[model samples]
Target: MHNESIRYLIVPGWQGSADDHWQTHWQKSLPNSVRVEQADWLKPRREDWVGELQRVIAADSSPVILIAHSLGCVTVAHWAQLAPLDTLRQVRGALLVAPADVERANCPPALRNFAPVPEHLLPFPSQVVSSDNDSAVSALRAMEMARNWGAEIGILSGAGHINVKSGHQRWEQGFAYLYRLQGRIEQSARRRA
Candidate 1:
C-alpha cells in the first residue's frame, strides 16, 4: 500500500506524549494518523494496553504502521505476542523507539508489570530505535531487543530517551527513520505477492 493510504497508529508511553513531544508532533503533522487511546495511561495494565491496541487495529480497515515509544513499544510486543497471525498481518511494520526497561530494578511501579520482555521475532517487519545514553534502556539491552525481535536497530549519539525531556522535540531524524520503514513493508508485501 502507498504511504498515504496506510494508517499511522500512535502509541505513546506512560502518561502519553506531551504536547511538545515528538510523537505528538508527528500525530498532529502526519496524515492518516491516529493515537490509540488507553483507558488509563497513568496506571497501565498490560492487558488493558494490549487490548486497546488490538481494538484500534481491528476497528480500522486500512493497513497500519505502528509508531510506538517507550512503554508503548512494550505494549506492541505484548499485543503482537497474543494477536492471531491474520490480525498481525494488518500491521505492515513498526517503529519501536526507546523501549522502556520494565525488567530493570529501578523501573516505575506502574511500568513493572510489563516485564519479561517478549523475546520472539515479530511476524511483521520492525525497527528498534534507541539512544546511546537513554536512562530507561542501555545500548547492550537495546541491541538484544533488536536481535530478539528480528528487527533492525539504530542508536543515536547521546540522545537521552528520545523524548521531550531529551531535547528530541520535533525530531526530524526519527521521523525520517519511520518514513523509511514504509519501504521495508512495501518490499515485504511485494515479496509475498
Candidate 2:
C-alpha cells in the first residue's frame, strides 16, 4: 500500500515544533498529512491534548498513522488508553520520537499534568525513536517507555531530543521510519484481509 492510502497525523510536543522542525517538514512534504492542532501549546493539559487528538482521529475516516514527537507521544499513549474500540481500530500505527519524560524532576511545571505516563500497551502497531543524550529524557527511561507501550525502540546515538535544534532538519532517517511504519500498517491490513 502507498502512503497516500494512509492518513498521517503530525503531533508536535511542548511549545510545538517550529517551522523548521522535522514534524513540520514532514507535514508539508507528505500528502494526506495533517497536524493535530492544540489550543494551547505553551501550557499543555493532558486531557485537552488527548481530546484534540481524539477529535482529529474521529474526524478522519481513513486509516490513521501518527507521527508524534516529545510530549505528543504521551498524548498518543493517553488517548490509546481511553479511546473506544472503533477509534483504536482506526489507528494503524505510530512513530513516536523523543518522548519527553514528563515525570522527570526538571520537567516544566506546565507539563506535570501529563505525568504518570500511561503504561498500557498501545492497541495498534508502533515504533519509538529515542536519543541517547536527550536532555529532557534519559535513554534508559525511553527504552522503558518503549517496553511499556509495546513499541519497537530505535536508539540514535548522541542525538539530543532529535529536534531541529539538535541539527536534524528535514531528517531523512525519520522519514524512513515513517515509511517502515506504513509497511507495517500494510502488512497488518493484509493479515486482516
Candidate 3:
C-alpha cells in the first residue's frame, strides 16, 4: 500500500477502546490512523453508530482501510448500506476482528436486538477474524457471517470476543492479518492499474 492513499480507520465496539486495548495501541502506533468517535459509548443505538461512522468517512480526505472489532464490525456493515455509492467505493479494505454478526445468538442480552445481519458485502477486499472459543458469538456463526459477507476468514484458537477483557493485548497475529489485507488491497490496485 502506498503511504499516500492509505488511511487507517479503527472502530471500537460498545464501551470504546480502553487505554490498554490493542486497537488503541495500534491507532497510536500507526500513522494516519484514527478511531471513529461515537457520541455515546455506553449505550449503542444502531443508527447512532452508523451516523458516527458516516461522519468519519465523509471527513476523510482519502480512501480508507477499516479495522473494526466486535460490534464495530457490525456498525461498519450497517453503515455500508447507507453510505453513498462513491463513498462505499472509496473504502479500500477492511479487517473485521471478532465480528459479532448474529448478535442475537449468544451475546449480551442488550445486544440481542442487533439481529437480522445486514446483507451488505464490502465492496473492497476484507477479512473477518474469529475465535474458536468466543462465547459471545460462536465460531460457527463467525464463519457463517464471513461467508455471508464474502470475506476471507482467519480463525484463532481461544480468544474470547478478541477484546481486552478476553486478555488480548498487542495482538501480533491480528496486526499481521491487517498487513495481509493491506497487501490484498495493494494487489487489487495493481490489477486495476
Candidate 4:
C-alpha cells in the first residue's frame, strides 16, 4: 500500500514531544498525519487523553495507524480497552515506542493515574519498540508489555527513549516499522477480501 493511502495518528507522551522530536518531524513530513492533541500536556489526565484520542479516531473515516510514544502508548492501551467496536476497527495498527513504566517506583505524580498498565491484548496489529538504555522503561519490562499486548517487539541497542535528545530525529528505522505494519495491514485486508 502507498504511504499516503493510510492515515497516521501521532500520539506524543507526557510533556509532549519537543519541536525537534521525531514525532513532530513525522507529523510535519508525512501527508495525512495529525497528532492527537491533549488538552494538557504537562499534567495529563488519563481519561482526558484517552477521550481526545477517541474523538480523533471517531472523526476520521480513513483507517488509522497510531504512532505513540511513552504515556501515549498507555493511552492507546486504555483506549483500545474502552473504545466501541466500531471505533477500534478504524485503527489498522499501532507503533508503540518507549512506553513509560508507570508502575515503577519513581513514576511521575501526574502519571500515577495510568498505573498498572492495561494488560488486555490490543484488538489490532501493533509493534513495541524499546531502547535498551531508555530510562523511562526497562527493556525487559518493555518486552513483557509487548507480550501482554500481543505486539511484535523491537529492541534498539543503547537508544535512550528513542527521542530527539537521543538523536532519533527523522528516524528512518521507525518509519520502516510503520511501512512494515502497513504491509501487514494490507495483506490482512486482502485475505479478508
Give per-model TM-scores: 0.96, 0.96, 0.94, 0.96
Residue pairs in candidate 3 whose N, alpha carbon or C atoms collide under 3 angstroms: none
Instruction: Kindly list the per-residue Cα lDDT of model 4 for residues 166-186, writing each as its tens digit.
Output: 999888778888878778788
Worst 10 residues of 1 by lDDT: 1-10
Q: What is the Cα-based lDDT of residue 162 in candidate 4?
A: 92
- Per-residue lDDT value at 168 in model 1: 87
Which portions of model 1 show Cα errors greater than 4 Å?
Answer: 1-3
lDDT of 1: 0.91
What lDDT tens digits, residue by residue, belong to model 3 across residues 35-76? 999888777888888888888888866889999988888888
- Model 2, 1-193: lDDT tens digits are 4656678899999999899999989999888899999999999999999999999999977888899999999999999999988888889999999999999999989999998998989988899999899998999999999999999899999899999889987998887777787788788889999
Clash counts for the predictions, in order? 0, 0, 0, 0
Candidate 2 Cα misplacement greater than 4 A, ranges: 1-3
lDDT of 3 at 57: 83
Q: All predictions: root-mean-square deviation over Cα?
A: 1.1, 1.1, 1.4, 1.1
